[model samples]
Target: MGVKNRIFKYYFPQKAVDLKQKRRGNCNGIVLMYHEVLEDSIDIPAWTIVKRSNFEWQMKYLRNNFDVVTMDEATKRVCGLSEGQRPFAVVTFDDGYKGNFNNVLPVMNKLSLPFVVYVATKAVSDSSIYWYDKIIGLLDKRDDLFISIEGDDIPIRKSHSNSKRWSLMQKALSKLKSMSASERDIEVKKILDENDARSFSSRIGMLSASDLGAMSKHQLVTIGNHTHGHELLDQISGLEIYNTINKANCLIESWTGIKPKHFAYPNGNYSENVLDALSAFGFSTLVTTKPGIWDGSRSLMEIPRLGIGRFETKSQFKARLAGFL
Candidate 1:
């Protein structure tokens, strides 16, 4: 919920939230978006990752309480192809982290949970550290750091340790969104080049091509497209949107022998233009970062997803699923 909903729910219309929850029938479903599933700590914001144990507990909670479904099942429910007789939920991971194979797949297998992992093809095929992870990886290795954003040189003196650097950079990284895709890439390259930064290994980076094939063969796992380079479609040109989608689609098909019909916009950054482009590419559905229950009221291409992050206890997860988010 946004500020408007919060104010209305608390100060004015106290029953508004309850009424909204009450109206959520069997047709409505919640899509949970996750980024990295790591067993160890990462030098990034905790909100971007969930530890292995926490994710397991979350799976147990969902299995016990909700009708966890696959993306195919979800599409049917949302598109009215299947009888939506009960509240449903879908678990999805944005980036194809190696943990999806090493850590996550085991847990999902143990729980028999159906989930989706949207893979950015380049990361897997080329074994590249995602741009965002590259930035964090480079910064995490240095205690004294200077970043050149635009013409400004911002220096960090106190951000020496891993936690401190992560906390400091979390806020600083958002500013890069203002720059053009080329501009941001150029600046990131400059910083890393001067610092002699090496890209993080795919062993701890993205899912490999083998992982893609493995997940594709799993009965409960569906591989989806993230993009070729994890490009923010709105920040780049329409040509980029066209090219990235096609390239990703092709690569995913080559690896998995099946083209993905669903996609997740990079960083959840998308507009109607992006949606139209995705639709033109024949993508059946796409998800956004916006938090809410999807009840077929919005465009299927712009489905809202609830983001689940680090250290989210079972109770907190239950409440969000219960529509108290």
Candidate 2:
């Protein structure tokens, strides 16, 4: 622990941390959303990939400190049915990353933790790269990146600080988010061509259908459809949105032989139309990127989740679960 952290813990005891038990039987639950879980690597962006060791530590923390519940149980508790004899939390992974099988599964199995993995079927079936990963690949090819985003030349300085790298990556993501689907693809392609990024295929670090099949068969795992192409509902037409959801759900059902009853909005992007589509499709439980403690109002559908990303410190993780952040 850092000296500052030590001093803070010494002086300001997290009295509320102990109150978790008091809040258990009647309190709201939380759903944690994770993405890729991989070993120490610098080539990938930190936002999408949680280091394997850090993930293990976090799981250990959850195992020792929190009541790690499943989505079904969490939904019931959120709907005013009491918590399952302890303060409840549900673990979920977004996107179908291969490292999930390689790194996260073993840890979760060892810990005997139940979790839900949300898959955007296209990423798995087509063996295609998610756009965000492409961006990271483009950035990794060079230390000093000078990109032209919407006519502005944004110079990503060569810095040793991860914060600086993250800032630049966030800027790139923002620029990409502003573009239409076609435009985004064009821009990513341009970057790839310019960088001569040959090895940046979608299959580099993502799960295959067989991997998903194996995971689905795990007693502690549940598959949630995250839509094909991982499209943002708010950005696409209603028809496109419906087709995406239908296509993804159908593919997942075909793969797992069980229709998915749960869904998570890609990138937490949604709208009234998006909610309607989810409703039309009959997702028994829906989750979003919104950060909050789940209660009666968030059950079955439109549930909010907390993103346990690399930026979060140990204390911040606890604080977030405890509703202190």
Candidate 3:
């Protein structure tokens, strides 16, 4: 192992994290972000897809080291209304992937841990695949395809390896992320049409309405709204933002028999208008992809979360949670 890995393995970072929290009066909490948890590796080129074993290990470590609290409790801890261990932690998953219900639930239930899973309501209602997954799936299947962006043809070579595919996908996603919702959708559709590709199942599909309903009934699971179409709120108009969130809120309420109180910005993209739109819709809490310790210093409407990626080592996981990375 490298020097940093060795230090993290020994948990030397925890002391620094603890001291930092201590210096801040021990009021900070950590909210972890995740997307999917697969039963095993299928060599997906995404960082958000954690394997079952790694997820379980991370959960167990959280259970033993930090006070794993609910979103409500974590909010309270942030506001100094509740007391717990220093550096409280909340687990959350975005995109409402089927793996969150299939692979994540059992382990979380076994550990008696509380977590939140945010859903893109339209994807669930229509049983559609996410745009990111669609891209990865299509690219992984062929070596001859090339994607045209901004009058440039980007080649997609399989090379019979994941590294090349991963690099290209990252480039594509970065470009897509910069585009408006309509533009991104049009580009994604074009890629799909040209390739004559359909998103094949490798356990990365969206959760169905039934799955969400069942998960909502569980004690450890709290379902949150991602949006109607999972559009980037910052790039859209305020009216569009309100409509999307409102639509998702109504759908989620219909499915779960309870209105979702929490919302997560799609792709962590948000602006002042986005914040205002969510406020108008009456969401009690909001989460973003921005990484930091959740102390009372920040607004509940723009809470920060540390995402746990798939390829992270145990030591890296520990160091990250301990606030050293």
Tens digits of per-residue lDDT for model 2, 1-325: 3465444433433566668546755456778999888777644545666778888988987776667888887776777665565667889999888888888889999999999999999978888768778777555554666667678666666664655676677788888987898998898777666556775443236788888888889988899989998998899988898899899988888888878888999888888877776778877788989888777765456788888876556676666666665
Worst ten in a row by lDDT for model 2: 4-13
Please tell me which predicted candidate would have the highest TM-score against the true structure: 2
Q: Kindly report which residue pairs in candidate 2 clash with one another.
A: 128-202, 129-202
Q: Which has the better lDDT: candidate 1, or candidate 2?
A: 2
Better model by TM-score: candidate 1 vs candidate 2: 2
| Candidate 2: residue 147 lDDT (0-100) | 65
lDDT of 1 by residue, 1-325 (tens): 3554344333433244345445776677889998778776553434666788888888887776567898777778877778654667899998798888888899999989989898888878887777667666655454466777776766655435544455556655776766777777887888777656754332247888988898899998988899998888887778889999899999999989999988898888998788777777777788888988887677878888988876354545655666665
**Candidate 2 local accuracy as lDDT?**
0.77
Q: Which candidate's lDDT is highest?
A: 3
Tell me the TM-score of each prediction against the true structure: 0.83, 0.90, 0.89
Instruction: Write down the RMSD of all candidates, one decimal each.
Output: 4.6, 3.2, 3.1
Q: Rank the candidates by lDDT, best first.
A: 3, 2, 1
Clashes of 1: 0
